[model samples]
Target: MPSHVWNGDDAPPNIHDVYDYIDRELKTLKTKLITKIEKQFFGGIEAIQFLIHIEEIFKSKHRIKRVKSLIPRISGWAELDLFTRTCYEVRRPGGGRDAGFTKDIQTFNAAFQRGIKSLTDLQDELKDLYCVVQTFCRNYQSLEGEFDLKWARETNLELKSAMRGIETLLEEAEEGVNIKLFSSDKFSLEVAETCDTKRYPVLRLFPDLFQKFHFSFHLIGKWRANDQIYLEDIQFKLIKTKRLQRLKHEEYNTLEIEHANLLSIIVEKRVRVKCREIRDRIKNLDQEITKLAGLKRSMMLEKSQTESDIQERKRHLFMNKNVTDIINSKDLDNILGVKKDIEILSKKLKSLNKSLKLNENDLVAKEKEKVALDTDYEDMRKSVSRSNQLAFERTELSKEISIINEKIQELEAIFYRKTDRNKLSQAFEDMKYPAGDDEE
Candidate 1:
């Protein structure tokens, strides 16, 4: 009743069942033998051909026919049985010792065993080569991506830092000015005369004609705003005649003070303008220094990454070289003479690595030099700032001094003319008086 049972009994005992059972067994055995032959012999053949391909890659060919010839041809169960029986006979004691039994069976056994061993060894070698090739290809593929990512990240950080510096500089530039170099109402001017001779009362009343008086004045005030200048007041007043004896000292002093204050204001404004220019220049230099520092940092990071990449590549190349050398020594030793070629290739790779290292070193050195230049630029910028400030102060002081000197000269000239008129008036009065008395 079961699918496997042909009749009602648990086992089929008829002639037909017996023949069917034998046929099924033979078919199963044949399939097994065919599968074995395909897997072992055909697979071994493919492996040998792969080795031949590898040999061709090295540009050499060594004949490997012994292993190839040992593979048995088995198209059906009959040939498979024959091959098995032959193997059994070769292994049996004293079975193939007769003269009629040729040495082909022994040779087949030797070659078959050698082929199996060689196939296994070649498979391992190919596996190693495949692994090395895969690793090398993978590294090559990822190298550029890694470098680009690192560079982008580092560049971004540098850019951010630079942006922050710019923002700070901008904020500082926007702040108000604090320097005040000069101020009004801090100085006074006066005029006076120097006399070397005593004059008569008439000449005193008219000193201009009778007495030659040198007029001069000194500025005697100290600079208060920022301590940039100082002056001490001196007098250069002319002797008055009878007709002009009431000169208003208070009014004249007030006028001179007002003039001096105006001059002080002008000097202050000019100094402020020059100081603004200097501050602007300093701001520009600060921006430049910040930019250079950012650039230098970016270059340093890039150079470091470049060196790391070069070292990684060198290590990978060294590993590849070692693998190539090992494969040449172990697998391709007899097949192709690749040892010398591999050595030469390794040497070339080493030289290339060395060149890359040197290039990276040069770039690093250049970055260092640029950093030094950035420092120098910063120093120069500070010095320029100080120099500009000092120059502004000096220029303003000089202008103030010149203005004071001009005022003093004008006042002195005015005093000289007044003294001369007074002297002429006095002479006229004395002559008029004498003539009137003589006529009486």
Candidate 2:
């Protein structure tokens, strides 16, 4: 709440204190303006004219909704002026935004809103870097379920990352910390034991620097003792231990490639971890799939056997037979295949013979029922014989059709022709008609 102590709770306390003072003064000014207008125009014919003249007192002097409303609105404008000025005091270098333009909390809340908007914009630009940090933060189980996602707070849908790169090079050659000896005095850094901090990242200088430039570059950051991750905070320190040569474009590329290689090594480590997990999952799935497959095969075999039994029951009548008389399945198959037609014919012939004998006796016996039965038996025998003859003819017809097909093919090949009886007769008549014409 002290003046000029801006940015407490990362906000400026001085801004608010100044706003409070300005607001009080504005309230006094409004009261004076209202009173001076009312008193000077009281009880006179020229009072209306006087009031109209006094209406030009403010930015918008037509009317005021309420004393509280008007004063507060005026106070807000004043506060905004203060807020903008305060931001100039502590504004970052090359910073385009001024503060009160953003954090106007008292009157219309313009300052707070615009500040939020700018910070949100910043978050958007750092999306990729934030994403990497988020992944790293998530890797440690301690931070897992308790993360504050800034992207959501800012409503930045694609703001997933932010990255801080640190580069340090020094020339002094030989102690573990002093790996380089330089000719010029400008850039240098020393290697040291790791520190514990949220944002420190560390890198060791490449050996090429020591061999060629007598300078080695090393980077450092705080690391978590438990998590083994580089600290979230990172800074670059170029120690001026000795003079060194400025780097060429190719050297810059080499430095960049080395940094890229370092990141790649970490990424590869993560990939290996992920791959191992995937392999384990695949193995488990394979086992489960194998188990399910075996179960499915078993159920299918049982289903097939049941269906076969049901079909067999429907196809044939199962007359009970003595165990000794019943044939085994293999023997039954052979008997039914080889001798079925002959057995059926023999049985039918015997039945016909018996019926014929009974029919012959029926007439001699002179019984009407017997005669009818005998006629019926004869009719049945004739039908059976006719059916057998028809079946035999069907076989003969099939053979004849096959033979005709072959003959048609042969005729086609030879271009064979046959005489039509009616046409032959007509031709003969034509020939006779010619002879008759000659005679006439």
Candidate 3:
């Protein structure tokens, strides 16, 4: 094999080339080792005794159980029996098994045959049984220490894993594993039948799961892409775009997530502003309504007092009519005195008529003013109602904004995981898998 040296600054060799070269080297080493052993042991020997000696040599190493067992199969009836049974099983799958299953079985059977042939081929290579045993013993002693260390280290990891599994089982026996059941309503009742009651910290449930936000503000804003959204004001003249798309392939998709979060914040800001404006307007309307009500009450009291004055004047006019009738019914001897009394009473009645007419005119004017105030008050109430509707629409926009934020977070989490996996894979691909030690 040609020696290859790796430079720190140079690019690593092709992975395929590395794999092919390793395969070639292993095959070459195995063939050369087998040839050397055969040449050193080329003589006559009984096959059964030869196989037994090889098995005995393999058995010396406790870790070599699999290879030791295979040695007997080189000349034993069990090997032929296994091959026959495998062939029979391969054909048996043809009756009702799937085509792919049958094909897989056949493939496995072929591999089994190849393995058997490879093992049995070593039988012919063992020419001089006594000489071959000595060579095997020597090779075994040379590699035994290294093999023991490698096997011990490999077994240690498996034993540790097993210990951990056993400890888990013990814990399960004492304190059972908790399995929670959840209802659609997000309400949970703990059922600790087998396990002891375990306290789990309370987690706030997602609002979207139970309550769907009204999307009445669909006209306000909407997501254009997974990471971006478009917003517009009531007049639709001011349009804003939020983007979170990645600039580079290596960059994280978190940019778009941040943009998604911004959408909610923006909506929240609008809601707060609109709410404040609505509140202020409502307060002004309430104050105006109160003033109108107070004015209407005062006007009503003034109207009642005017009506009472008119009644008093009418009563005096009636008293004067009775006095005038008495004067007319009196004798002609006191005509002059009666005339004077009549004149005074007539003047008083005339003054009362004029006052009554003035009061009636004032009442009519006040009634017209009161009607206008009532109309104004009703219009103000309608304006307040419309403002409330707008506030509700803004609230709906907020809920929808929350949902969009959650979706962005979910997408970010998924992308983050995939990005990590891709990074790890790229790192592995970039790694240099050395075939052997550096050559000078």
Compute each candidate's TM-score over C-alphas: 0.21, 0.15, 0.26
lDDT (C-alpha, whole model) for all candidates: 0.35, 0.32, 0.34
Tell me the tens digit of each residue's lDDT in model 1 across 1-440. Answer: 33663321222333234234434433443343334432453344543342233223112111123322332232222332344344444342353333122343333334344433443343333233222212111111121121123433343344334333323322222121111111111110100012111211110111110010001000000101101110011121212121122223333444455555544544544555655665565566566556655665665566566556655555655555556545645454433334454455556556656655665665566566556656654545554555455556555655655554555455444333223445334433443354458654
Assess candidate 3 and give its lDDT.
0.34
TM-score (C-alpha) between model 2 and the true structure: 0.15
Model 3: how far residue 83 lies from native, Å: 7.5
Model 2: per-residue lDDT, tens digit, 53-161? 2222221211233322423222122333343343334343342322332232222223223332333333232332232222222221111232233423332222211
lDDT of 2 at 382: 50
Worst 10 residues of 2 by lDDT: 215-224
TM-score of 3: 0.26
Instruction: Give the alpha carbon lDDT tens digit for every residue of 1-440 in model 3.
Output: 44764222233243223233333433443453344322222213332343233333222321234433433222122333343343334343234433343344334334333433432343222212212111111111111121223432333344334333323322332123222211122122211221112321111011110111111011111111101111112112111111321122112234344444545444544555655665565565556556655655665565565556556555655555566545553433345444555565556556555655655565455555546555654544554554455456555655555554554454444333223445323433343332474646
Best by TM-score: 3
